[model samples]
Target: MDSGQEALTLLLLAPLFFICMVIEYRILKKRGYSDYSLKEVVCNFSLAGLHQAADLIATLLLMPFFLWLYQFRLLDFSLTPVTLIVLFILQDFFYYWFHRASHHIHWLWASHIAHHSSEKMNFTTAFRQSLTYPLSGMWLFWTPLMVIGFPPSAVVLIVALNLGFQFFVHTRIVKKLGWLENIFNTPSHHRVHHARNPEYIDKNFAGVLIIWDKWFGTFVEEKPSLVIDYGIPKQVNSWNPFVTTFHQWRTMLTLALSTKPTPFHIRLRYLFGSPKFADNAEKRGTTIK
Candidate 1:
């Protein structure tokens, strides 16, 4: 039942992740970038374990659904290079929308917030993943490929590959790759994505292709005028991985349930509104208007 890529990627990339982490650390240390801290790295590894474990469990649970959907596909897709290439492009397209939705929708943001909780940016920071990402509507975004006849196994493998490529882009050590920065998701684009600055928030949602952000009008160049401030607008302020994972959910639930005296529309807004709308309301001394 294993997509070969799962075992293969773990076998290969596990060591590669370690080596890359060491390389990035050395490179940053040589350049005198001291943002990488021990506690944050521990949390990153712990979160990565939880995140991948959830992905494995979700794959087993959802395999049947993907298989069932495959039967209904209008056109059968092979795992040939041409097909995989197309799906990779297609998957990146779907990823942009899913990533965008996670930013704007509170329910999804609860799961995604953990990834942006880290104050430091580095290759290891990419491992700061949400443990509940499967339930955050990530797999739902890839469903169209299954319905379009990509084999369940191929769909799963391609997703893993997309993520594998994404891990390398989470660093500050890399500069713009000249023309490559325009077409693909590079460290420059991804740094802007991870940045909390006003211009960077909710921009550059593409997983592999920077073109999606460009085409969708969500692209922003890493500004020379403004420094990239990494992490979420409202910092989590703790190294507890559990707190990092579920703090957003707690805030969302408290707001949603505290609307006993407020209107029904406000409760709905609390549930479905922007990531920090409830907190922002309290900050501004205004109820949902």
Candidate 2:
């Protein structure tokens, strides 16, 4: 599917998104949890708009490259229900790595940080995406599916479905779903992913299935005694959509410029190294050893 049709697929689901958000908002409000705010919701959807626009433009520009790259496929298979299921699993596998890398690599974290910038974990928090994903090379993660002989359109559709399924996992409304939690990414698991708590910081990177995290040793069960604190380590501190969207990028650039008279690799590290490296370097006024 082209970007237009892919967008329509998401659009058809927009009402569902809105309805979930509304229900979650009402429940949280009645329960006396201050998870939603008008300012944050507006900013969240604003970032969503920016993210969608960026994705649409990037998809249009990169479709031909994906198509050209498809010619070099190692294998070709017709799209069947079984094949589609396989593709979905493969896409989720790739997404697990992509999500993991975004946490570990500063370059990608600059784009992903915005999604975790909000302290709230309402349904709208899932809408808080960064426009910098295209620049950060998120699409490259899915190119492997194309090279593996899946049609680019099929890959894109599966990606949309994967992300759509993820929206439900962002809420705090649902508790752990017994056996479902064993195989799927539940709200509890995702809350751990969004938590700023030490043990939860890099855990639970599953896009849809929890098995990837379990297999890779990144899974952490939510602790009832340990209250989850949502948001990144360094808070963005602003509800302004633009500020939140580019705060980490600005921070990364500043770190790169401030660490001056250093080796070229050190400067690159400011942009590409772990975010912890950047944070510590900025604090100590020197590179991480």
Worst 10 residues of 1 by lDDT: 1-10
Put down candidate 2 lDDT per residue, 210-229, tens digits, no spaces.
Answer: 99999999999999999898
TM-score between model 2 and native: 0.97
Query: Ten consecutive residues with minimal summed lDDT in candidate 2?
Result: 1-10
Clashing pairs in 1: none
- N/CA/C clash count, model 2: 1
By lDDT, the best candidate is 2
Q: Give the backbone clash total of model 1.
A: 0
Clashing pairs counted in every model? 0, 1
lDDT of 1 by residue, 210-238 (tens): 99889889999987678888898789998
Q: Show where candidate 2 strays beyond 4 Å.
A: 285-289
Q: Cα RMSD to native, each candidate?
A: 1.9, 1.3
